[model samples]
Target: MNIYKIFLLISLLFNTLVLQAKEEKISIQLDWLHQFQFAGYYIAKEKGYFKEENLDVIIKEFDFDVDLVNGVLNSKASYAVGKSSLIIDRLEGKKVVLLAAIYQNSPMVLISLNNSNIKKIKDLKDKKVMLTPDARSAAAINSMIISQGLNLKDINFQQHSFKLEDLISGKTDAMGCYLSNEPYILDSKNIEFKIHNPSEYGFEFYGGLFFTSQEELRQNPIRVRKMHRAVLKGWKYAFENIDETVKIIYEKYNTQNKSLEALKYEAKILKELAQFEEGNLGNIDYKKVEEIKRLYLLLGLSDSAINFKLEDIIYNPKKINLTQEEKKYIRNYQINLISNSNFPPFTIETDNKLSGIEIDYWNLVRKKLNLISAIEVINNNQEANEKINTNANNLKYAFGTADYENINSNMSMSVDKVKLALTTLVDKPYTTAITELANKKIAITKYASYYKDLKKKYPKINFVETASINESFDLLQENKVYGILGKLPALSYNITKKTISNAKISGIYNENYELRLHVNKENRVLLNILNKAISTITDEERKLIRDKYNSIIYEPEKDYSWVYKIITFLSVLIIIVVINNRKLNKEIKKRKLAEEELNKIAHIDGLTNAFSRRKIESILELELNREKRYNRGLSLIFFDVDNFKLINDQLGHSTGDNVLEKISSLVNNTMRKTDSFGRWGGEEFIIILPETNKVQAKNIAYLLKEKIANFDFEIDRKVTCSFGVSQFEETDCADSLLTRADNAMYYVKRNGKNEVKVV
Candidate 1:
């Protein structure tokens, strides 16, 4: 206890106290009751990873009333574990920010027994389905059901009791269960069951996401990034050493009283969901998140029409991993930017300056990569290719031209995919199905890279060549071609414009359009620089650029002087003819007006714009004769709006009329061009499905039911329809066929509405 020794002891004690006081305390809310699902948080705390980052972490287990999102938003917790529904929450104006996606694919699925006979999603239709109240509106479960051609309103949904015995006791035919927890229990009991995963139906979603409020991220970004890093590290360690993690969880964090073997099984399945074998832990793909957002919109889960920026939703604190040589290349070398001027919505030459999405992206890339460049507008891809091949003007690094396939062996392309779409007029006898394009005329721009390949693949297709997309559209408008094939972005751009009315995107081109940044392979550093630049450009920026240019009307400059001169000549000639035969002209005009009015009244329904009853009868007669002569399958779907009179009484007749018009428009847009849709009478419609049988027609009816049930009508009213399907028999005439369809429809109406019945 000498004076000097006592002072040294006091100094060490003071430093220790300071270190302890500086450690920041934070808590994370789990999404469900404590189990191995939150094992990463437990491991991070146990292994002192959070402590190493100067974080004092508290793990909050979920309860029946715990709101995971609100817990974080209201500052009750610093972070939270959530599922894909966070996407809908964010779109609905929640300030939640995602830090990491622990599970690549969600474990949420509908489970049933082998003996329950609920094998497919449609089988659960009228069966007692149990779901947790929280999961009733979950994006993964609901989207799968809707995507499988079943309406949510049609299913018999029961509140989940969260007990496995209920399902075993035949109290519930199917239950929304977790693949990680419930499946392990059923397997232990040797229960033979079937899994209906949303992924199987193309509704894959991320699971076990770590998220925090934007306020926390904005106020303490460094701490947030450190916490994110530590959590990912903990996950990596947990998956690699599953036995040790399971032992730790069973000892300390097993709030659910899980057995050792059960925890081990959970960890095994979680490892697969984590996708750690790919060696990229906690990595989120922008494209995947964008798709989930779109699915939410499609499922009517998101209330707002505003688009959420994926960059804002996903957290990426790391900078571009560029090598020193690539960095130096970016600083020293100036890029030679070549663009195709005729590529609408991507590149366009206006006032000798190229403007479009490509230019906008280049500007952002330039600012991010810190590269100096100038854009050169080359109207033709052929000229751009020649310049790129020859390295004209001794250019060292050039990029941003569309035609990059096999142009030069020394050139390399960026790792981004682009696609083209087939578009056709909606009213014409053309469809989006590629198999039906045989012997049909399709217009495509000349010098397109896939033109030769398409011609070689489908020799029977007559691909009409045009100088540009504008010319192709001209051909389409004049009814000279069945459809037009062009860049997908261009087609999307035209849809918002009045340039092409009543046009629909039929299908995507089979061959991928190889449109990417082309750099000389010899310049590897430059190639790396370009790749890094493109990868770092966020989807939000791309969307903003697309929206800006897609709104622009990009009709090519045309000389209308010759057309005016022709009109003037015709006007003079018409004047002379009118003067010569005034009385005869008046009589001809009167007769023509009468004939036009009669044609419109006879052929088209005044309210819904569908074909009139007489016209539909004529069409049905023609289709029946065709089927008889050719011996092909033919079926009809007779349907009408359910509770039509009630809607008219409650919402007024105008609202009812609007519903009919919308239904007509929806059917007209979705059905195949060859299939004829017409208004049979008030609140009734018929579809003539040529070459389709009863089962196929019933499937179509189911699709219509799902669509109409989900469509958002005015006054927040849900609209549904009753459908009846019937196939023509060998001895059946047109009248007999109609009678059968009509009878089946009435049967559906008699029994509950909003269902399809086949006869």
Candidate 2:
């Protein structure tokens, strides 16, 4: 061999090395600049997780509407951090599909000063709130406002610059903030703040998702999956050893004052914030994606959108290997059939078939269990419910009806309340001035829990009973009754042009009812699956599905121009008539003014112009109604100023009011719209929180207590509130609820004022 042969061999080996390096270069674009929020990607890079996967990954920072999704679609990048809004973007024909969600819950929140007297999402109504012009925060706030029965136009918005200045200066009641960022700033500034996280209130959407083009998902799914696994490993490492990851981030960015301690704290927060349970880190909930899509549609954010089904968006968890015996057990188990009606939508009928959410859910359960049999649907609620009760041997496993009360004795049943919009209206003549119909019969399904209150409220009126909601609507149209109560969607469907057109909806009843699947005593296996399925279907998913098809039928506006002109003409013609009605008009105006004053007083805190004790009580009552009616859960917290007498003694009487007013304002500012804050007594306050359990309530209470203790009251005086929380129980009376909360508060008092106690 000569020198020329050695040179040729060396050149070939060098070329092969270059080709392998080219294949390994992978660039990923993130949705935003680097932070703990993107720690997983950073950790993966730093810890050699990506390197182990034989990948050289470059993570690019996205800025100023730079669509990384478009980069993926165009093959410029392999993957990117996709915002929850990416679902909306995809629906609108963008070529990106979410691969995984970094956060299980959305981190976007509405933050307010510790003294703005604005708490909860509902409090933003008719109030000024600051918003970022182009973020998911705006969409979330809008959706929240709409859900509270208020329109976007009802509230005023100031443009926010991602700072706490507007809130600090009291220019805006609340400012949009991320739970991981702005809250830390507020804490560092020693400024107390309240945060309203939309995710907690059913405004469900994914955040910080890993996304790629559908084409990429199809072409290189294995590579995509490998990336996901590595990303997850990185997240686990970062979560477990946050200090090291924070140091890496600080060193990489040359952030000298990054405060590794704060970064570690933020990491711990992110661990809870990110989706760590369902799959590894960065797994997107398909159901949540579908919900976000529906929200986008409702918000009118997209046009000519493709319908993305739940199956299309979610990344299914990796398949787990199972033994043959386990597979057989899953395959052979028979799900009981309970309900009868076979109602379309809830229970679809196609080619004499039956399928819907219930069917789909049960099927998923069977698939998960490796079961082969299908869940059977019965014809009527009575037959199914009755059969299950009467003969244990008839069908040990049956899916039937169960109300809140049905969960009592005699029969063992698992109840899942499906939230739906329901409304009712009396005939025009009857609604206006018909006395005879005041006592006339109104129809509702007999076993339905919604009827219990209506019947109790109007005991004197004749109650018309029906077997099903459809029959009740029919009876109303046939003049057999004065009013009909039914689900809002079904009622709206019946009054559509293709259906009955003569009927008109005049009134809406705010009743949230549970539609449950009752199981017989002997069928524990089927009941367990049913319970699991219900728990899996989150409140946000239910709301999204309900709002998706429940079309809003706007009534044609009345053309009152001619009528106004005629009335004006008549007014001129009948000067004497006008003179005679002057006193009446004055009285009416006075009454209107009085009513306005009363309404204001009802909502305002009498001692501090925040919210009154009555207002908080009313809110708690309403929340209780909503919880029971919807079969959801909530927490009520009672808080009292610890050693309030000390403050009064040190600062005089007027100073006490000022202190009270300051604390009252702080409490009001700290609560979410879903939370109601009111002064319960001289120095005691109550917070009524909807859709919150004891644990969340405790966390919120702790934060509040800490804020109150650290807050500056302008006079160098310090104050703190002791919190006592009680979760709403099924059969709990209002007094019992108060007593339990009082007990918890006393326990908090004994422990120390600046503490949270839960009952």
* Highest-TM-score candidate: 1
In model 2, which runs have C-alpha deviations exceeding 4 angstroms? 2-24, 71-78, 125-134, 137-140, 153-160, 170-172, 219-223, 254-257, 275-280, 295-305, 315-759
The runs of at least 3 residues in candidate 1 whose Cα sits more than 4 Å from the true structure, single-residue gaps closed, are 1-21, 156-159, 319-759
Q: Which lDDT tens digits does candidate 1 get at residues 598-710?
A: 99999999999888999999999999999999976899999999999999998899999999999998788657657888899989999998877676577568767877887
**What TM-score number comes out for model 1?**
0.43
Clash number for every model?
A: 0, 21
TM-score of 2: 0.42
How close is every model to the real structure, measured as TM-score?
0.43, 0.42
* Displacement of the residue 566 alpha carbon in candidate 1, Å: 99
Clashing pairs in 1: none
